[model samples]
Target: MKDIPEGCMKKRGILFTDRQQDTLTIAGLSLQERMIRTLQKAGISEIFLLPQQSEEAIASLQSTSGPVVCLTTSLLLDPRLIEEFLDFPAETTEGLLCVVPRREQPLFPLPAWSAPADDTVPLPLFLCPPPLLPLLVEALQQGVQSFPALFTYLQERTKIRPRPNEGRFWYWVRGPGDVKEAEDALFQTLVKETDSPITRLIARKISLRISRLLMSTPITPNQITLFCLGIGLIGAFLFTIPHPLAQIGGALLFLLSTILDGCDGEIARLKFLESRYGGWLDLLCDNVVHVGLFLGIAIGLYRQYQVPFYLLLGGLAVFGVVASVATVCYVTLRRKKGSGPFFTSVVNEEEAKRLKPGFHLLVKINDLLARRDFSYLLVLLALLRKMDWFLWGGAIGSNLFFFSLLGIYRWGRAL
Candidate 1:
């Protein structure tokens, strides 16, 4: 379990609406139903739901045996709720736990009572969410008791109880239905962790769903890798067809293939299903697709344009040499390390770690060119359809320059 924040309040319970939207309307659930769940779970004798009007809650407080807690919305409570709490019988007022949603500004006016000056002693009340009950109970077992409030509290607990031996891995194999929900929750938590929201929300959602489903099912990661490979092969075959419509169809399939290619490793990581064979399969399939795609595009472009066969052959040579060298280096390092090497850079000790801005500029230029795989493929398709040598030369030449720099960079780093 993750460590609780030091000095963070352990809330008694949280109250919130079922709807997570900005606008509010009359909810079908009454305050009684909402309060009843938390109160029963926390073993509280009385739950006072402070509606906009305070007559009944106030009346109930007058006759209650123990301290009374009121969970209310800021808009609904206003000054009246404070007045009601203050008017409650003397010792009972200390037990007054006010629950409200989080806010940028103070939701309501602070009551007259001051918290103890020492700050070490537990406060009478807390303000937090309802999902924290198990943690709160564990803390309570240690003879620590406090009050907390929360903006929104959900009473429903997860049905699939996790075990200590599970060690986070078993959480993945629990299957698809609840898996998506778990992924959504994990995404929300992760989003709150980073400084830059670099991961696009939709991409994260897709990644999470894929991760969950892949982990839960019996499907091997190699299957996904092979599927991508087969798609890429089909794309290459489609490119060889003489029809314009067929070329377009092939390009579409190739793009889909590239996108699906992103899911395999993500699934492995989420489920702790990492294996040597799976990693090798992914690496081999990825390179094979990349080569097959361009080779097929070159074939089609050559047939359509009938330009200098030398340029097409030259492009093929450049693509093949660079791809082969990079694949060899990556595979060699992986075999040596006994694991995947993509995320780990095997930099040579002799290489300088820092570079000047001029060098940086050059590096950026090269990276952009090298990253033009999709662009080149698109250009090849366009050229095949239009019989344009200028476009074809531009695409292949740019990529050649890109790959040349990549090879040099790899060699420099390896030195």
Candidate 2:
């Protein structure tokens, strides 16, 4: 049992029936662990678990002064759904017993309980006020162990309000079939709802396929990031060798690295392994790779032709990359503070309205050019042995994009 501040509702509790213990392991973690993590992610600090016939169950009542929510451990529930229910606004006197039902459907064959006035069906989850504990205990003693039986009993005795489960994301993990269904559903849920054109068409598809394969292994997202880093550095090294074959090989390697870069994020999301450190580390590694690749291209060009122009172009291109990244970082930080973690290729609707028309147009142009897909063109140029043209184009494009963004941002602020 955990303590809550004065007047704050007692933290949510998970009630694990004896039968659920055997099927607790799903997605490499016990249901207890998964539920606890889900609560933590939802900013819930205090929590209590009521294991069947445990001393903690008795102690939980004595320690916590507020309501206790009892949910079965057999179900793999979505944390967002739980959070929404807990945060739902209601009058205190409306009901002492709250039931979450299957979305728009009844649970059992109790036609009397399935009144049209009810919005949600009674699932295995319930929130019982401290005042209703004795009644709950008495009902349990009377062999009312099942969720539907308990809900029916509560409805007959007290004002029980049914809350609808809008997103039906929970699954009862009872067998191998359930496990397979959960894996597929969770993978689908992990995919980003919106993405850039290139990411949607290429990187996302590649990443999802690779992520599905990697999830079965013990490989971590950080390891994937390191692997990408190694590939990118190798690409840079190849670019430094003054030969057409080396140049083409480097270009191919760079493209491969870009494709694989999506894997780290995909795996992290699929496994709920995302962290602030991982996000920052990914950004840092990408910047380092960009710098190395640009510098290597410049060095290789100068070595082949002994020209200062290639060196200058390389320097400019590297600067452009740095400047563009810095600008994006600054913008993301501001947006995160103002809104949330909304870092997309194109500006969101609200953000678009906030920007000047000129700035918005420039942003769209930058979005078109500043994609990983654009690197495919670089690879094609390398294969054609026209690396010089690619270098010049890169330098000019990158610099223009950065300066335009900076100027537009400043102008918007002044306006």
Candidate 3:
């Protein structure tokens, strides 16, 4: 969750009128509470429950020298929407900013910018300056219980502008059917632009199902990461055995570990538990598993073939992996300024142009290869009972990969 600091903006949210379905649950948390959490994560300082709020609460708003976000309890807002809306200075741009649905479907919360607002409908969500706080309190006290009625009262006083909706997700959770739709909308957010084709097409399908099962449970995202680490370590250890069956089993476990890796992120993002520490921890755990895998495979191969060179190759592979990973972590953690989920590598064509023209093609190919899709290849090699082939490739290819990463880092300016 990204927080907009108080010095930047006084972020406060208020649900003016309460609805009967305020307790309606979505993904184990109530719809209202989920909305509150979303607002708070977006850096809301104070959230007010109007009509039911104490005199102190009303007194607090009178002193606000900044904007306040006002919404109804009936709708479940998208976090993206709230964050974007906060960026617009409703206090100065317009006396008030209200986001309306498409004229065709007023009940739906999502709308295109081209879709004109139908004024007959009420304001589900809006933002206003502190000067209008008295009107907001008066509306509720005057028995403007319905959104449509409240919309009229506000419009009569304040100059309201209909803002465009920039988000892909949000739901009007008024009933039981709406609750299911809201949950589905939230799940759709797990899809990301950075997902590899293998993870997107195959692994994500399974991981998302697992995430759904664990979503409502008491288990946290960090807990899930540790559990997967244990499973992956066990799988890595299996590669130390000389037998083909153990090596094959280890490969399968490594692939399983790759699939399970998707879950921690999904859980973290869904619950707004994403942090810089969590990001670093996840990346570190992955590198640790990779180290175990490379060494274990080399040890197994050396034992089976009685070759001393395999041990040397393993040492080189480990060194390359560590060097490459250190560079990426250093760039992402220290060099990069702002954050979301960090993009480790896989530069776009334009970004690749920073390097030599010849390197451009290799960078494109490498970006495609970077998507963790290689786990599928590993499983395929294990099925053929040729684990040495993978170790051989890992030994040589790992070093080449490291050099390519080094080149990219050295050449790129903004990376």
Best by TM-score: 3
Q: What RMSD, rounded to one decimal, does every model reach? A: 16.3, 4.7, 4.9
lDDT of 2: 0.68
> Can you write out model 1's per-residue Cα lDDT over 266-328, one digit (the tens) per residue?
554433345667766776677676666556666765666665673465365446545644655
Predicted structure 3: lDDT? 0.71
Tens digit of per-residue lDDT, candidate 2, span 190-290: 55655567677777778778877887688988899889889989998998899999999999888888888888876766556777667766876777788
Model 2, stretches more than 4 Å misplaced? 1-10, 15-26, 30-32, 53-70, 90-150, 162-170, 331-371, 404-415
Q: How accurate is candidate 1 locally (lDDT)?
A: 0.43
- Which candidate, 2 or 3, has the higher lDDT? 3
lDDT to native, each model: 0.43, 0.68, 0.71
- Superposition error at 383 for model 3 (Å): 1.1
Write the residue-wise lDDT of candidate 3 on 178-248 in tens digits. 77767888778887776777678889988989988988888877787777777778888888898878888
Q: How far is candidate 1 from the true structure (C-alpha RMSD, Å)?
A: 16.3
Model 3 TM-score relative to the real fold: 0.85
